[model samples]
Target: MKTKHHILTYALLALSISASAQYGSQKKADNLFNKFAFADATKIYHHLIEKNFNADFATRQLADSYAYMRNPDSATVYYKKAVQQDNVPIDYYYNYAQALRGIKEYKQSRLWLKRFKEAGGLIKKDRYLKDNDFLNSIFNAKHHYFLAPVNFNSKYSDFGAFEKDGTIYFASSRNLGTLKKHVYGWNHEPFLDLYTTAKRTDSIVNHKSKIKGDINSVYHDGPLTISKDGKTMYFSRNDFNKNVLGKDNQGVTHLNIYKATLVDGKWTNVEALGFNSNSYSNGHPALNNDDSRLYFTSDKPGGFGGSDIYYVDIKADGTFGTPQNLGNIINTNKNEMFPFINSENALFFSSDGHAGLGMLDIFATVTDDNNNIKSIINLGVPVNSSKDDFSFFMNKDGLSGFFASNRAGGIGGDDIYAYNRIPQLKIEGSITDATTNAPVPNAVVTLLDSNDNKIADLLTDENGHFEINIDRNTNYKLITQKDNYIDNSRTVSTKGIESSVTSIKANFVLNPVAKKEVPISELYPIYFDFNKYNIRSESTAELDRIVDLMVNKYPYMVIKIESHTDSRGSFAYNDKLSKERAKATYNYLVANGVNASRITEFNGYGERKLANGCDGTKNCTEAQHQLNRRTQFIVVKME
Candidate 1:
């Protein structure tokens, strides 16, 4: 009994110490993460994990650490492990949902959020209204269903859905392999085909099963959209078979859109949308409610780049006019495809070329009377991922939709996921100069995707206020740049977090040199030890001023570094020193990121070029000598 008691006492002591240590470690980890020392916090979490102390929280903490460190991939792996441990808190689900969103698992994130809510998790409904992840810019409390990409059974990798009555139509490339040969050494999957599923409107979420369609093809076919009246159907297909035959077919290998008429509740043979479907390749069609215009994707020449959204106005005879480029405002030198126009006159689309959540997430905008459209705003976290997420479609009511993604937990490559739109909203903020406190107006504000594309350029107002409407489920890079100031950037991803407006203030201090009148010459100054070639300490101060000047006028101004030597040295020696001096100055400026184009040739006038009559004697006065031993900045060009 005595020995047993001793052992028991020892066991209790050990347990106490272990518990205390675990709590202490957790505190340290929290502190580290709070300070943004993600790497350091990660180390501590790993140590706790190895000890098997609070394994669930430790793993999650580690995952959060990775997220804070800007390493989402690693965070995702750990978050999954934590979830697997079971008995994890709803907060774990929240963080895991965020990781899923960061990696472009919009559907999966939705599932997690749903699970969190169902598990007695109470979150502010208005949180998403202001959160960066919520981009819909409109909200409805009744629309609460979130479609998690993981909810799709592995049997079908589907996306881009349009519903009518009891059936929901979506795109999938499962089984049929007509485009299999068109792998093109890339990740091209089988051509997508439209499928229908059963649905009911009463439940928060309605399950779907694929429906048969006669227009199914061996080629890529899918991303089917229907007009408001459900009389017109649009889908995308690609003839990869042409490439399998070793034929040079540029237009066929890509996507080709088709239009079909729904007669007597059945879809007929799809007809090519005509000249709008030219040799350059066009696909991803979205018809306006009026049926007078069809928006589609095309990579035709004279466009901003690989693919740009183009539309054809329907003529009275049911024919389309020549496709006109949507100009640089909406199109960029990047791929902008997969468009969906909702009944509300809002345009939804996916893009790698536009700023977004990840590789390719959905974006939307409302058009104005001037034909000018608002910026394409990314659908936040739960609906977007770091992987390719294209093929977005929505119903007229904005309650349900579909999108494609190749994120983790999917059945295969680029699986199509279904999701009910969360009624949350998008809120945007603009950064301005505090002193002027006025809008930094016309500042180039770029939203980066996972692929790092500047998705949009936001201009500030007279109040220095820039704002954007957003939907739930997206990620973005908010970067601002203006003349005479530093470029500032921020990364925001909203997954399972609360919906709340987040305002970021990126105020810039415009340098005096960045203003008019202060020329490049005003910034450069070369110092010398009386008449010597060696750079002096005083010159560093002058050079620092130049460095500041360059920062203010980046991407503009072209200047040259020229050096001269006094007659006190031999012609040969003076020439060599002058060259060294010029090179030194040039190297310094270049190292500091002054554009190489801004500064050009460095001429060594040596003693051959004397600023003042360098009395050809070593005993010259300092005033006369100072002229020949120096460097100056000459402006080559100005913006």
Candidate 2:
């Protein structure tokens, strides 16, 4: 792909620079900037800024120069200030967002991307907005990878790893023990060249030498792919063929994909592909499992975004078929490049088009026999970060692999990392009230592992959220308890989970104890045989329920006991009998551990609280008279 200079407008931007008229001539600075001489342009821009000469305009041009120079940390500092100007173009917002990712400011990156979208710039559809659990899934997938740096990493950019015959072939800008004869203006580093390393055992080999087939060019080259048969290879390089560097009408050199044959232990018959054009770029080639199809990235017309992945059939006679686009399912309005098809036919590529943790994330796709994409998944975490992660390659076993990332803690501009799959499992969990569905905050949760050992003691937050990390192929039990709610527990297992799944979510709810009103509206018969006062065995069970609530459930509940008698007995005798019955009920509760002070009153009404006018002379049935022989425990003060 062409560098950022291809997009810089000299005449228009220079005119705009002059229009900002708070300064001396900005023509020289704008001219050098447009001429791809960013180093000189940056110096002039800095000089103008030091003079306070059109500072905002100079700052924006300065940031663009640094961006084209491949220093995002420096570019972002100026971009952050330049984008704040009201007259700045919408593209600045988008560029600022991209620059932010280089510094791992993902939250700010997304914000700027959103602001870019609001300012009428095209942006990828955020799948996260449609799926609430999308981001958690990313966090879980991140645990599956363990990334480590290679021993051969240099102070310069070292990336693009490919492996065959236990030998690693990679691209590097290292000088190979010589002073820099030629340096790319983009990053001021030596132009990239193909390098080889001999893999001995489990560890990655160090950089030993370059390819031995007249492949080392004085210009930029490399990032090659070897066929399964190891008989043929395809690689990327500048438009340098036959000692001539081709340039387009814009006077910019574009990259081209070239095919080479391995003969007599050395590469030979190198030539550019049929689709090579001086106008656009075609590079980062990949080959399918059987070598019948060759895939590569290009920015040719009539495709989506900045770049797209295309493939061609490798004819038997060494001719190539027409290139076909991978289609919208795999391509997006943003970039999709560096395609790698593993032995299992899974297509892995790097992209900023898909919603991910940050800038460029590696993605994999499930493809059908005809190369039709079925699904796309983000390879979250260790293999990816907020920086650019691309050029993914894997061994035949699919367990071990390598890729490049410019994320933090790297050795150079971009560092190649070796990685293997590491299974990650955790529980994305929540707690809530079972009745109202409201969050149950401050709930104590206990976790027991498969071995019946307490593993974690967790307390939920105000929003009823708890994170639990667990093991694969194991069973776990969760017990949650909270104040004013009944204790509850649940059992979960990670057994039989698919290999791709990283986490098993555990959500729980709690139910508040029932709050029954305490009144005499529905009273049970408190019948004593004729004139006696004693608790019945059957009635005592129901009475114990009230005692349990006051003593165990709600310890602060206060109540008063009341008993009534029918009109059959004399008023004075009935009153005394009723008082005895009330005292008996209260004694039962007090004996059952209910606090004595909780019994606010114990009184009785004798023939006064009557039912159905059943006076002694009225000749009422026993059932009708029994209605008045009832007890009431009225709630006085229940906290």
Candidate 3:
């Protein structure tokens, strides 16, 4: 039987090897993939993968093909499969993470990125894994921006919005149908073209139409920057001349910057800038306020990573200087593109290298007098999301702006989003004694929203003052607490406060707790067993209540503990035991939080102050004897 089983196993193993060999050769798939024919390459890879022939490599290649083709949904499946196989490459982990993020699987993407980092030999692990305050600000910050998609978005990718003079100019891949549209192999979408629409109102934009003149070319064009004077325009376009596409040594056509002059109400004199390159992409032009500096993104030699922001001086003679990289402080080993400068001299750009919420997040960097980066701030959400967010543009007021995002629930592949900042509300208050109207320093003042969630807590200064910023159109509760005083609370609302500096005064008056004299009989009694001085757990509740009353409610009150015992033992023995019991009660209160000095005295009177006839030789019930063996508190003094 054993020999027959071994023969069957051998035959099965051979059959499996023969079946795996039936899958087609790997060379065929590589040939089509190298030619950028990803659609056809994936078919052969899928067939080989079904037969489990070179499954790991086939899965990774299939994922890479769909990823290069900009189909993250399809790529995610293969990438997931590739990652499950043993000894997968490190790059496969990163690609899987990016693919997961493209589909809004944020938590899963982070897991893969963590795995990618742990695989060792990563050059930018520290840069990518560092904790970022800007990334955290997205979750803890108050909702200040309201974002919504614009009306002109189409089914294709539409982004890179810039508003100039009453007209909104942006880039889109929507085919106009008048000309033979060229589809980009990357996403299989029509080439990007510049379109313009009039800003009908602050929130609404009119129907978009193709931009006039030679600006809209047969190939990719747009993401333009207009000079302050509105007479000059600088735009990005593919390296195309007279319907002929230019290619570099790697056969990749790069983007170029072109400048045009407005002649007789029409954009004319269009010419490629001197910095235009055929080897590397340089596009997304942005001009400074005075037009003295032109900022753009490039993948040129010596960049930190995929794409970096670079600027060239537009000299007095209108000639361009050599492009200067923004340095490693702003650029990283990953891509950073879509540079925009605001009136404040702050540069806003999108980067995937920085520690972020997952994918490309928008960041703002400001430079000091020496042109060194002072600080980099992430724009955070809802201006940014796990998906790609870039091309930020704002008006002079800074209260509103437009940007681009490929996050879910958008109107197109990448939609233009408008945001408006909501005004902030301020709350300030004073904490004072109710009877004397004196400032109560060191009092805790806390603010909570309508859901009873604590918003902020601050201690009152010497002047009994506290201040905090709050959100508008919300209800809140202000609570004040202090030692030796009753806690006070007030409900306040900023629902109707519309002004930018609306300050609400919420003064708190806490009443001091009065001293009270109570016999230990009224308060829960501390009883002792025969000949015992140890404190009991059942008596702790009443003892702690007195501690709280003395330490917190009546800080100036002094307490006197008195102890008594039954007459069963000798007079001298009972007296000593009563005193020990009194000392035990006093020590417990002091140890629990009551100040030692507040305990004015502790004394015992054994059998001398018996409450009933059970004293000495009298017959008594257990309850009657227990009542005589009790500890009591007396109000000695109140400062």
Candidate 4:
């Protein structure tokens, strides 16, 4: 036994020596790799193979070196050789998978990803998807990436990209010692500069073109909207026009729209666009395909609130008339910016005031007839997160474009992200009380798909407004209910319609279900945090009591659960949150075995008063204030 142990120890030591020697070669390769001397690293790695050294690691290193050198074909050969020798390191698998994906070996790359995931590898999904050298063409490929935030460095950042005209235009605020940074000095960089890359498409590093004649001097030069004719350029800059030079020489004070004419294909003459240029912040311009009209953003007091979409017709006299604010329906008291008009005349913008997946998200709204907000739909995930996601620009095909986000994980601060906007369907509406005719604030609205499985739950606003964006090709049952009130429901079909946004008005009227003498119990079971109308677990028991009463009183009574929030912020903001919170509690009930059809409504009050003192005041304790945060049940049907 002692002799056997000695033999095993010696064998183990020999294997360790071999692994250590192999690792040493890989280490040397890594040093060269870090310096970006790929060619030299490849040479050294190949030399190891010639010496019959740890060829597995050497071959993989050689493959990476070749890939960095843009010699993908040679890289593939070496990667395959390494894999053949059981060289299945996570890095090796990731690199090899990327190489395969680059060469269009999608199936094989997927197999490798499975193996890589199984190996417990922590690979960066976003890096792989965004890397030009990697295969990023597959649909839904970005899902693997862990969303992280871009580090908050002081560099001005916005969405930017290389234009088809060979002029590289992007939003930035690098300062470069400019006078006063930007006009408003909003947290984002004040001056977004336009840079062009010298037509050297050979190397990725050489892509940065020069800025054309310091066109970006003071103000915010960003969201560049270039003309297809290449003879004109339209951009959104802070309200500081060189033409607006003050008597005492104070700088332009507001963001305004500007146009530059390309003389001899060179952008030389820049002029402040006529009447359209306002004293308020007017920026983030988007153009019609024909260049006949300009679409932009402004907060000129006449607007809906923070900022709203405004359009001006390019008159035959080469002057813009009065800019028109897209009405109250489209513009809310909440901030709306980054308006992009597509070829279809469909308007796309970013809004914190709309129902969305995050802080600021991309939304598409159609302005029809009276230019009302016909349909307001959210552009969901990958394109939207719980961050400040905005600055939308899509290509003609409408498949891809660039957007700016401070979301997690990027090469730099607030890196510009390219995403494919997946088409979706959004259902929106208001839930009100049938009896009171008042908005049934804090109501739960659950939507079940064709399989009778609950798909989404949305709450109504202070005014009982709700909006939901989802995918099409499904049947849905919208159930609304609140404590003490009967529940209500409606069947909706999302098929055969290209509607991205649809609004319905559904309200539930609650009949007194339990005898008033039973107990002076809470009207709703859901509770909100102090000053918040959002539903909390503490309110469940009270809500359950109502649900039990409904189940017993009429035996067949269908109840609707709804939520409400007090008004605090802007209507757009309060309205959106109130609607969502109402639906959350509705979902909880349905998940707990309540009949979907029996539950009728969910709603949010936003800042609307349910009880006057509930809107958060020092006059009440946090506990008492929480009493105002509640969910209600309305009897929808007694069968």
Candidate 5:
């Protein structure tokens, strides 16, 4: 993820500037923009643009207003115009790229990103320079998702989905009659409130309603977490009370996490967490499986990025411990938020700090026993896109769950989407020696798809057992090879597997290559026309098999190709023809990927080693003569 400064912070900065009489309308629009009042600011900026008053600046500000409002459609229009102006700031170009990505215009987004990088005044190196190929590879990669929009989405922002006990809890700005209606200036939408729905099916949901209580407030609320026991809950809300509205030095109110306990079937005792502060924002809380640790995102100072994921320990006496930053492995110089921990202790979060397709992408990482973050992996599209994606939640099964994305075709500004992971097929078996029927440990097994494209490579464990997951409804070939053994392969297909995870047995038995030479005729016969030196088409399959063995199985083995002829012509002429045939065989192997250096020699042995009595003086059937006129391969050296 490239570091694009948080546009919301810029809006706050704009509010701090004093108004000047010389630029009355412009100053007013700037003031509105700083207050996160994007809707009204948009109008003021648009009016100034119509009057042709500082049109370029108005255009950029207008775009910023829509962008911060999560309306990429309108933002792109003004951003496109703003970037055309001479000496436009590099951030504008980056903003334009994000807008393009929001609409699924990836190709155009990439082009704008190129221009952003070329402008070249970045403090942090562009991640795209190293991850463009990787990000692009996702389009062609196998994705198991079966994605669909949730049924209850409204035109307003609807996101932050979490499922517990067959009921789905989410945060949305949809208006309700019982709640006092107040619009958030950021998007001119009703302040967010927690809502719940019941799952009808894996892909369908029903019974949407806002939670009833003091939880619904005039200010923003929700994007919550429930304890495993379902008795306690932690949720995000603005730091505003009836008496006082908390504000930071920048005059921007921040979010805080509050805890509420279920008493007599009602959520009560809502209190802010001890660690929350007015000086910095903290929200989007998630608890570990046992609720011993709480994870949340914050823009607190001394953090590595704009917002970073942090966790605090919950003691036995219900006391809190010092918050700990997840560190660089999970946090970067850009925002990382919306942390979710699955059953496997793998942490999933959204980050704009890693290399991704576009704006914030969802990433997952596992931690060791010491609770240190390890490698991080992108969820990839269609789970992730060029638009802001966050608030990921899934079950222990890893088969299905919900996430939020502002990608195109969504039902609202940021819609909650349900996804089911298609069933995966597995191929599992053991490798053994043909002679002894004993496990062959450490044998290399390679998997290839129908097109002979390599899929995966594995080594047999001490028990000679190996198991690997493969794509469903695909044909595959498994090649098993080991030192001093003849390689073998088996074809397997999962075209009809219907289970969530189907495991099919596919065993391999490899023969040990004898100390003496092994004849190629034992594997497959090679036939030729009476006087032809060119390879026959029927022999290609067998020849390719040999090539695969030499390249993958016996890298240190050298081979010798022997071509012979029946005692029909003069020895000199027969020898010359035999040599040509042997050379043709050798060339085919080399062209098919077997290294030329691996072939020790190819020689003609005309009538010297006849398979049967087929001498020129004696009359013999054509079958007997054909047996004498043949090509053979043997291992000349093995090291």
Candidate 6:
């Protein structure tokens, strides 16, 4: 949790070889890789891996080579192995995820992307949007709530639900007692006023009545907090004082927190909080469990962002002390409103700036002993939606609660909802091929706890799907494996889940051990001058390529070399010249490190093999005759 601020900051080889003793060192492999000579790099990597010399690094480099060569299928195979080793770095998770995506393993890709995000990956916008585990992690919460709109919601905005002393008190835009329709311009409805009704588990709260006092002002008010003793109340109201509206220089009416005392059973003596100002807004007042401090939202100048949460000491003389901003951890550069601290000392608030489903999602805080925030966990799913969900009020039991939302199917602009939290204990997903997108039926999926202790193992059905119920609020790792496929190990946790999601998706994408067509190297025949048996300067470069191939690129590759001469020379002379040319070619390769045994055959063919039918009888151009003096390399055997 201390790392939350930093969280978003963000193949190949095959073939056996002859004489493993001749294998290159890690330095040689790295040099080839640096030069983008992936084919050459792959060979050295394979040899290093075979000898168990820093095999983990070799495997990762090999996978990267395949990736650079645009072979994701092959890259996936090696990456699967590299990632399993504990010594590898976090970026491997991203690379493996991409390879999985390249092979159409989206489900598996999401899993690895999530791993990357949790491991403090360097964040790219596209990847983060594609897989936000922070949001997904909410689905793993133990209890999912069944939400239903409270029956008393009106067509106008009705929200800020709270309960005390067997009565439900909330704010509503409903016409207060049929006084002439006075619509607040913000939402084109009646001015918000405090309303109350008897608390009931069923049926409508139709017996609603407006709170009577000097408290119900003609301007906006309500969304109030009541003390445990029920004598005093703190509520938000527009800066309408003494029957006059106070505005800032811009003629904007800012809200203020007003205190009202219940004297002789009827509320009176309404007074504005000391920090209330005409230049800025301060509203949404709440009290901590002990009431020593008052928590409220304010757009004051000294805050972290838009409307920050602040607390002021409630002095014994009824005068407030200096207001302290909640700091940047819980406040963002957007509106943070409706601050509520349940009896458990857990502070819940609504914000649009944090990582959430959409506008104004409610988030709960986890704090250390000093009240410093550790993590601000979003209340996901039913408690939150792609719309405004806020004013979360948790009951004493912590399982039954009321909140408000403007989500689809709500009765009004913002509808209060009642819910009971229930258990959600299963994981669901399917198995499929990373490259093929085909189902991997019969693949085994093993579930393990945070300690790597096995909890259960299950096999996928014909559709490659499986589901297993497990204990809640626990960390688990999923490992899937099948013959001839690379295994996938993914970690997940059930935390910050406060809504109705019965299961978390844990899909497995199995990447096959890819076998591809032999990589072809383009070959151009090296040329020689007429009657020349010595290796040409240009021909040496091509010969050197052949050496690298046999020694590093293809260890088991076997080749037969044949050299030819032009018709300009006598048959006997040409035959001797061709023989010398072939010998020279063979020696160049062997001297440059090609295993001598890989040279299957080396022979000379004289004028009998003239490229054009010149035969010394017809007049031939020098260019045409030059072509006949050349060497050919044939693949005698390859694995």
- Which structure among the candidates has the greatest lDDT? 5
Worst-scoring 10-residue span by lDDT in model 6: 6-15
Top candidate on TM-score is 5
The digit string of per-residue lDDT tens for model 1 on 401-449 reads: 6676777767665555667644434335656664565556555555555
Give each model's clash number.
Answer: 43, 1, 0, 75, 3, 6
Q: What is the TM-score of candidate 6? A: 0.48
lDDT of each: 0.60, 0.73, 0.74, 0.58, 0.75, 0.73
Candidate 6 per-residue lDDT, tens place, 115-173, comes to 88789875553563454455544554333567754777877767777888777888877
Give the residue spans of candidate 3 off by over 4 A: 1-137, 177-179, 200-208, 242-244, 424-493, 498-639
* Ten-residue region with minimum lDDT total, candidate 3: 6-15
**Residue runs of model 5 more than 4 Å from their true location after superposition:** 1-133, 176-180, 200-208, 241-244, 249-251, 366-369, 427-470, 476-492, 496-639
Q: Model 2 segments beyond 4 Å from truth? A: 1-133, 200-208, 368-371, 423-639
Per-residue alpha-carbon lDDT of candidate 3 for residues 8-42, written as tens digits (9 for 90 to 100): 11100001433313222455676555433456678
The TM-score obtained by model 5 is: 0.52
Encode model 5's per-residue lDDT on 81-129: one tens digit a residue. Answer: 9998755668888789878877888889888888877887342245334
Per-residue alpha-carbon lDDT of model 4 for 389-420, expressed as tens digits? Answer: 77766666454456677676654445566554
Question: For candidate 2, lDDT tens digit of each residue in 147-222?
Answer: 6557877777777788898888888778667744588877677878888886523333323477868676877787
Higher-ranked by lDDT: 3 or 6:
3
- If the candidates were sorted by their lDDT against the true structure, best first, what order would they fall in? 5, 3, 2, 6, 1, 4
Q: Which one wins by TM-score: 1 or 2?
A: 2
- Superposition TM-score, candidate 3 onto the true structure: 0.49
Q: Candidate 1 — what's its lDDT?
A: 0.60
